[model samples]
Target chain A: MRPRVALNIKSVDYEFLQEQFGSKSELLLKSNPVHKKIPVLLHNGKPICESSIIVEYIDEVWSSSPSILPSDPHNRALARFWAAYLDEKVPLFWVITAASEEEKNAAVDQLKEVAVEMEGAYGETSRGGDFFGGDKIGVVDIAFGSMLGSARAIQVRVGVKLLDEEKTPGLVKWAEKFSADPAVKDVLPETEKLVEFAKLLSAKFKAAAASDPLRR
Target chain B: MRPRVALNIKSVDYEFLQEQFGSKSELLLKSNPVHKKIPVLLHNGKPICESSIIVEYIDEVWSSSPSILPSDPHNRALARFWAAYLDEKVPLFWVITAASEEEKNAAVDQLKEVAVEMEGAYGETSRGGDFFGGDKIGVVDIAFGSMLGSARAIQVRVGVKLLDEEKTPGLVKWAEKFSADPAVKDVLPETEKLVEFAKLLSAKFKAAAASDPLRR
Candidate 1:
């Protein structure tokens, strides 16, 4: 059996709360008062913040069934490399969506650079198999796959499309394969729900930025 | 025999590199071309960039000796929490050292807040243990312990100490115990060397900031 770990998972859903601040979850606030962010997994009442680190903890705790990381060290490191890259780079998508026209264009250019790096990292010729590490889905897939919902929404909101089969053919295939996986598919929010949430969040950020001129 | 996973380790004497930039080794550049930073580990020619991630990879690959992480899930998560906390919070020291008088005072205030939080997290009153977990050294120690070298240097450079025994008795005792460990002590850099290097880096950053008006 998986260890009895308490996970205070949060999202931009409001049925559980009054408003969708995305950071209003009481459990999250108690655990990680410093960052006050979501996806804080508390094991034995002690909190481990950061989503990627939490996933790593989960993988270590429950080593049976589907292993999130690979057995080989090199392969595992590669998986981790991609995960870190995604965490460090993918936030630009939201920035692009929320930016002014000039800033938005600059962010789009940065996005293309990141996309090109991803393309190079996971090229058709290199990752010729199903997933990022080939054969099975691992942490890299989970890390990048989790962001795809937001990525799609950001693309739609910003009027800039990325991750096309023609443009990023390998990444497109990988995203499709990742979504189809039973385990991954189980946790993903619906695309429509996520898009609506993104729109709301964008409006909120824009409004806040307008009111607080220092934000720009 | 350990598996022949490609490994590149470094003793990053940042102080030494400041005086003699030639001492800034090529491994940092080779391992992380994109970030161009240090504490990178290259596994099978692919770079795992972040220091914490590198430590985890090292522990996973070389599991024979001392286990950097705890076996229990709860303890492991707790270890990871402090490690992430150190990474997120400890950078304030550099900021304080480099800031103007007003900014330095603000950073000092922020540092005090973090110190209180850290004391609460791993203090004698809260954890009631020797190390971050209990009894033995673990990943939290490694993650935070590595910073002790820099912490000591920063304390000397800034002329303000934050890790005194009386103020944070638990953390102080923990740091003392951690520094005494053979594994940690063997790898740590000399305090004098580190202080010298910190001075050089401070000057470099100041010069760069002066030249670049956009630097914040």
Candidate 2:
């Protein structure tokens, strides 16, 4: 489940505002005017953009419970490396699926190459453990896990499957383990809903691409 | 001076390897085979790519004398937000300078917009503080400091200065303070050398752009 810090009495009013305003809330808009994107974590009225960075902020503020990142510097760096690697590379999956047929083909080739690199970077053989780091589900897993939720949607919409067990067995297994985690499982969107959202987004993007001469 | 970690006696030889390797170093090639970029910090044997991330890793690893980041979580998050923002956006300065006149104009406009946003994000009123976070030079300072060095080169080569005191007074002062810091001062490449490097890179990029029909 998406763990939220217990709101104090004063924050109750702000929490109510959050629920009322939803994604397009004035607070979110004010905090993240440039991107105006969701997942903007506002702390003390200042907004921190970007998902992975927000996760790190959360971990820092609430150090009482389960640590999101490892304590050791080397191990933490390794975890962060995988997190960043996933963040940098995984966006291409959506970009590829959203492109025209010719562009899609090129994206497919690029995706395959990236997948190979991912395997080498985080595969079971290389990492020698269930998770990217080892036994625990750390920052790296969280990073990859966030992306996997959307991967299937992109694959289905594009009719190009990239995350099959037969091809990326290690990655497939890791995803399964990550999704099964209590914290992760609680927070994840329903797969069916996510796939539907992707279908809508893909259609919208394709339609926009068709209508826009500049895009063409 | 750029602080150097003294590895164990046996690993001193590897220090030479680190220094010798540039963009094409084998260690860098292996670690960041995808990007094949430099500034990859290899701890033990694993590689952490991305300069900002590497700086954070360095700070976490060497938590002894001078901490590069603030100890408080809120301040730390703010520091990271600026660092990531600079990393993502500042490269446009180089891209603009490296492009053809038409593309160069577009890039310059984009860079100015980003600069405005950065200035606003930094706040118009100065904290009268030396670095990004209050007193000491921190992670955000390191990230931006490195980029500003390159930005100075791009500005000189392209004849379009973006970080002016009058336009972005707070940021200009921040840059000046950051560049003058003992640690940052020692690490920065000479401005003349960086300008020459930028010119060479621009020439190379223009040549490649001419050859690549897709870029056109």
Candidate 3:
């Protein structure tokens, strides 16, 4: 979905292939033999794994579009820094759903803290503009925006508000702006749908754990 | 050390500020507020953290040097993929020194597997050239090359060889070639010195654990 948003933002045509839960295709395994995960963008038959890397590749290949990363080198570094930070926090989202209640609360707190820092990052990068990329959705926006579905579903499932208006007004507003963007609106999965999907996923995990307690 | 190697390769003279083992400097804290870690490159007072990001930043800012990333977009994506893979494997190095004996053996086995995969990566990316960047070291070379000192020291301290000549001949050869490069030879620490440093670090970890068993 993240790469699709990037492709849409770049105005490039692509074929969307969805991988089913609890199973992977031979194509995915062959394409991404390292991680064998999703969001692997196949361009000219070469696979680019990792959402941010694929987004950067999209930006580089489709140079005619507005740049995803900033023009200045330092600003680009900051953009990449924020993108990496978002990626680093990915495991927290998992812990929120799968761990003990204390661990879930801790993950929530950490994510809230991350949202605050990202609020500052949005302020610094946006320069009073509407989005993290400053008036247009850039790499950082896409990176964080990709996770909003899970964040929203986590809110619904875990009863925790991560990006609160009072605490991180900038991020809250940016999340709204990013979600409503035409390039991503259609690509971003619906919150309720994601909630259903998350339920199915958690059930699968429980089943797997019942079969093999040492699944991890 | 990784950033310094890139700076040297780029022929960009810069000042190096060493951070102490236990305490971070005010500047280091301010520069990299998020990670508060070392190898933050301060250029014109703007800080760029993370070794790979800093190397890419150096490449972008200092455009005249032999390109750190490949010119082709696909190759660049591949380079980034391999670099990210290397970065992801970083924590296992810590497990080598800090974890239990069984865990250390598992880490060694995992690292050896990683070396085999990286050998395949080197074969694909090098394109019959001497380095991962095809004769002139690029980002992947610097990424893995930066970790060579620790890998060599691990081989000495842990009684295991990760990048074995038979199992991962390409990576083993690449390691030697990368270490001998003029830009990185002086920057790479000696294996014996790194082994001693690792011993001290392990001892410190043990002392810290003794003081507080709950510390993660």
Candidate 4:
């Protein structure tokens, strides 16, 4: 999704290849033998795996209008830092449908803690109003922007709000602008379909947790 | 360690703040509250967390000579890919001290598989005759170089060579050059001390695996 938003922002034309989890294409397997995961941007026969790396590749190749990553090295590091934090911390919110309510509540609290840290990370350094890398949608914005789409679906599915307006007003505002961005909205999956997909995923997660022998 | 090597390669003098795992300093905790891990480069009081990010920061700040990352965007992406691969795959080798011989053998096999892929990655792309990212000890070299140091110690303790010369001659050669590099050797801990450390770590791993309720 980030790669798509980046491409769209740069107005770079490319084909989108949707890959199913169980039936991944031979191209994906061949292009990304290491991970064999999706968002493998195949450009001129070369495949770039990993979402963040792919986005960087796109920004480098296009190198035209909107830059995803900042030009300054320190700012680039800080953007990478927050992007990495989002990757590590956002997944903890996936246990919203853990087998027990206590576990679910814990996941919510963890999400809240991560949100607060993200709020601090965005302090006084924002370029654009509300975006992490400031006014423009930089790498960190795309990183969290991609997650916010799914987070909205999860919110609808679980009937629990992870990004509370009162607690994380900045993130809330950023999400609104991010979702409203023409390029971002162009690639976002419909909320209703996402809710349905989330239901299926949450069921599998609950089943896995219930059957986990190590779970005490 | 990669950060240290990058700094050394660039001939940038800086202070080393050793961080204890069990009791991290408040500065570390404050500087990197997200992960609270070390190798946090605080240049001009701004914190750069994550070793890779720190290395990139060093390269950008002291962009005078011996750049760790490739200048080409595509090559840069590839270097980042291999570095990320090392981070993900090398840690699996640490599980070699599993409770059972079967599990230990499985871990060894996993390491061998990772080594073969790494061999292919370094095939004709080497610059420095025996280094990844060519002969210059780039980011990929530092990434794996840091791992190879501990791996040698583990080899001494376990008496099992994970980097079989026949299976991974490229990596074997690369490891030798990496260990011999002045920048790398300057920061590496003593092999004998690392061996003792490996022994203690293996014992703890075996004990934990033995008590693992999930293990059949």
Candidate 5:
């Protein structure tokens, strides 16, 4: 999604190929045999794996936009740090949606703790912009915004408010502004569909939890 | 260590402060409060966490020397992929080193299998430069080379060979060339010191394993 937002922002023409998980394509396997993961951008017959790396690659190959990363070295490092940090932190949100009943409370508490920490950090760095990367949507905004977008639907499905307006005002406001942006809206998955997927994941997780004797 | 290598290769002079793990400084915590981990590059007072990001930041900030990363986007992506892959796969070496005798055989076999796969990949892309990025000690070489340097010491301490010459000839040869390189050797920890560290880790792991009912 970060790559999509980046390409759209830069107005770079590209073909979007959806990967089917149940039966991943031979091409995907061949192209990114190292990880065999999706979001592999095939540019000029060369495949780039990893979403953050792909975003960087896109920024390098098509140097026309206001730059997905900032021009300054320190700011660029900050952007990359937050983006990578977001990737590490996003799994906690999923833990909330996927945890069994016994674990759900703990998971929600942990997620909220993470949210509070992020709020503190985000508040300290806020430039009064509509995005994490300032007035425009940059790499950090794209990465964190996409995860927060998914977290929104997960919050709804789990009926646990991890991103409360009071507790995480900075993140909540950023999420709202990110979701409302035209380019972001164009690439975001439908909220209803996301909720449905969350439900399916929750069911699978519960089933697995039930079958485990230690949990039982 | 990879960041250190990158900076050293470019002859960038700076201070290297060893962080005390027993009681980390408030400044270290403030510099990279998010991860609170080092190999954090403090350039002009701004902190950059994560080794690969720091390497890129260093390369971008000081553009005098030959670039650590390739200019071509595809090649750059490949470098990023392999560097990331090495990060993910390096833990397997420690697993092999620290596994209890009962698990040691399995761990060694698994590590060997990884070696075989990497050998195949390396053989296909060999450019006779004794490095992953070819001709010069590029980013991927710095990363994997650092790990291999440690692996060599681990191999000596564990009395178990994971990087056998016959099975992983390309990697073995690359490792030899990398360790001998003046820039890389200048920064690598003393082999004897690394062996002592490996002994400490192996003892800790064995102690933990012995107490675990699952392992028993």
Candidate 6:
């Protein structure tokens, strides 16, 4: 979703491959032998794995309008920092489905704390605008925006509000604006479908955790 | 160490502050409010946290001879990919200190396979040269090179060879070459000192693991 949104924002036409989860593909294994994960961008014949790296690679190669990353070095570093911070909280999106009550409570608290910081970041970077990039979606926007779908799914599945008006009013608005954006509207998965997928994944994780506690 | 080595390679003279481990100061807390960890590069007045991000920031800000990262887009992507890969394996460095025997064996096996892939990566990136940046220590070199001190300490403390001549001949040679490079020799810690630190860390981690299983 990150690379796709990045490609869309860059106006680069590309095919999307819905890789079958739990089964490795020859092409994927060949392209990204290290991680063997999705969000692999095959440009010309070379593969660029990892979503954030692929986004930066796309920005460099396309060199089109609406540059995904900022031009200033300090801005780029802040963007990278926020992107890393958001990506690090990815498990926070799933811990609701995979954690114990104690862990779930802890994750929720941490996520709320993350939301407070991110709200300030969005406020500062937006400069009273609608997005983290002040106007169009930039790296920091795409970074957390890509996870908004999963976050919504988790919110529904867990019957918990991770981002609400009181906690993250700006983020709630940002999420709505981000999902409605023309470039990435089709890219973000529907919340209901993701909810069902989350249900299945939670079950799968529960089974895996039966034997391997670390799966949680 | 990554940013320091890159700064040295870029010929950017700077003061070094030895941050006391365990107890983060107010400056660190103010600079990097997110992680509040070490390796925070204070440039002018702003702070850049995370070693890898700091290295790229230095490369972008300094922009002199001996480029830390490559110029080409694909090559730059490859460098970032390898850097991310090596950083992801950071846990493989500490698992030996706080892991079960079976888990440690699994980590060892995984590290060996990582060595195989990294050897191929080094061979391709170096192109018959000494460092991953071909002639000088670039991003990839600094990425893994900075970890050589701990790896050597682990090799001695754990009695397990990670990058041996039989499995990774090029890497063994590259390790020596990277360590001997004047730009980063002082930045890399002494193995004996690191070995002692590793022992103390292992003991501390064991104490933590006694209460929390995830400490390992």
TM-score of model number 3: 0.94
Report the lDDT tens digits of candidate 5 across residue range A121-162: 676556777666578888887887777657668667777776
> Model 3: which residue pairs collide?
none
Q: How well does each candidate superpose onto the true structure, as a TM-score? A: 0.77, 0.82, 0.94, 0.87, 0.87, 0.94
TM-score of chain B of each: 0.77, 0.78, 0.93, 0.86, 0.84, 0.93
Interface RMSD of each: 4.1, 3.6, 3.7, 4.1, 5.4, 2.4
- The candidate maximizing DockQ is 6
Docking class of 4: acceptable
Model 2 C-alpha lDDT per residue in residues A120-142, reported as the tens digit of each score: 66763235777776776667767
> Each predicted model: what fraction of the native A–B Cα contacts (within 8 Å) does it retain?
0.43, 0.48, 0.60, 0.69, 0.71, 0.55
Clashing pairs in 6: none
Question: Compared with the true structure, what per-residue lDDT tens digits does model 1 show for residues A8-90?
Answer: 11111211223246547677678778777666655555776677777777777666746767788766776777778777665
In candidate 3, what are the lDDT values of residues A106-170, reduced to their tens digit? 77878888888998888877887888858998888888998899999998999888898798988
**lDDT ranking from best to worst?**
3, 6, 4, 5, 2, 1
Judge candidate 2 at residue B20 and give its lDDT: 41
The two-chain DockQ for each candidate, comma-separated, is: 0.32, 0.40, 0.52, 0.48, 0.46, 0.57
Residue pairs with backbone atoms closer than 3 Å in model 1 (clashes)? B15-B197
What are the clash counts of all predictions, listed in order?
1, 2, 0, 9, 0, 0
lDDT (tens digit, per residue) of candidate 5 on B37-88: 7878887777888887899898898877778988888888888887777766
Tell me the docking grade of candidate 1.
acceptable
The segments of candidate 3 whose C-alpha lies over 4 angstroms from its true place after superposition are: A203-216, B203-216
Ranking by DockQ: 6, 3, 4, 5, 2, 1
Q: lDDT per residue, candidate 4, B1-216, as tens digits?
A: 888899999998989988653388999999987687787998998889899889988999999978888898888999999988887665465665333565566666666777788888888478446787776889888887777766776577667776867988878878878888889887877878777666667776777666643321
Per-residue accuracy of model 2 over B83-122 as CA lDDT, tens digit each: 7777667546656647667667666777777778777766
Give the range where candidate 5 chain B is weakest over 10 consecutive residues by summed lDDT: B207-216
- Report how far off residue A180 is in candidate 2 (Å): 2.4
